[model samples]
Target: MEAKEKVYLAGGMESDWHEKLKQRFHNKFLFYNPKDHQLDASEQYTLWDLHHIKKSDIVFAYLEKDNPSGYGLTLEVGYAKALNKTIILVDEKSDTNNEFKARFAIVKNSASAVFDNLEEGIKFLERFSIYVG
Candidate 1:
């Protein structure tokens, strides 16, 4: 049997969508939630974040505007990109701004990109799996 891929969830920390990703990808991939850990030092935590990104085979990001967590998600996306990790971007209500479009254009061009729904995103990721077991 082929091994399941490990996907890192990069998104708003307090958002409820994390659970949805967990439920949908549970069978095909192992999802890592970086916010679950609490480290004492800021630098140490940053290192941990990078470690998690490095360990992941792919990254699934949820982007939302006016979200305080957007900055962190953006950083994670950039980090994953630098590591050459496969990325999947989900943005349901994206603003029609040039900057937002430009920033995510590369990801949209290369990896699977989904908008407006969780089911579509889940279906998109399913294509990457060669086998369930």
Candidate 2:
């Protein structure tokens, strides 16, 4: 049997998006969830994130105006891009100003695919899993 693709989940910690993503992609992908790891105020958290990003086939990130966006998320996205992993970025940019200037170029261009809605991105990933798996 073919191995399931690994997805490094990176995004806002405030939301339950991780659970939602897992529910949707459970059969098709395996996830490296940061929440399952014990990440305190230490360098080990960053190390773990980088390690998982390196190991993943896809980097799924979610960013919105309501949720707190941080440099850590930007770092993960850029690293995924550098590694040439399939990047699926869900950007809910409702503002006319477009606040996310450099979420590592994710708002405009960095990701392999960008979506306005989370469900849309999930659908794309489902199809992607079918083709790539």
Best by lDDT: 2
- Model 1, 1-133: lDDT tens digits are 8888888887777667777777766787887787677676878877887789899988888775545435666677788888889888876435545676666565555544655455667677788776758
Q: Which candidate should be chosen as best, given TM-score against the real structure?
A: 2
How big is the positional error of residue 132 in model 1, measured in Å on the Cα after superposition? Answer: 2.9
TM-score of each: 0.77, 0.86
- Model 1 residue runs over 4 Å out of place are 96-116
lDDT of each: 0.73, 0.79
Candidate 2 residue 28 Cα shift, in angstroms, is 1.5
Which residue pairs in model 1 clash with each other?
A: none
Clashes of 2: 0
- Per-residue lDDT of candidate 2, residues 1-133 (tens digit): 5788999988877778899989877788999998778789659999999999999999887776565555666788889989999999877743423445533354348788988788888888787678444
The all-Cα superposition gives candidate 2 an RMSD in Å to the true structure of: 2.4
Model 1: weakest 10-residue lDDT segment is 107-116
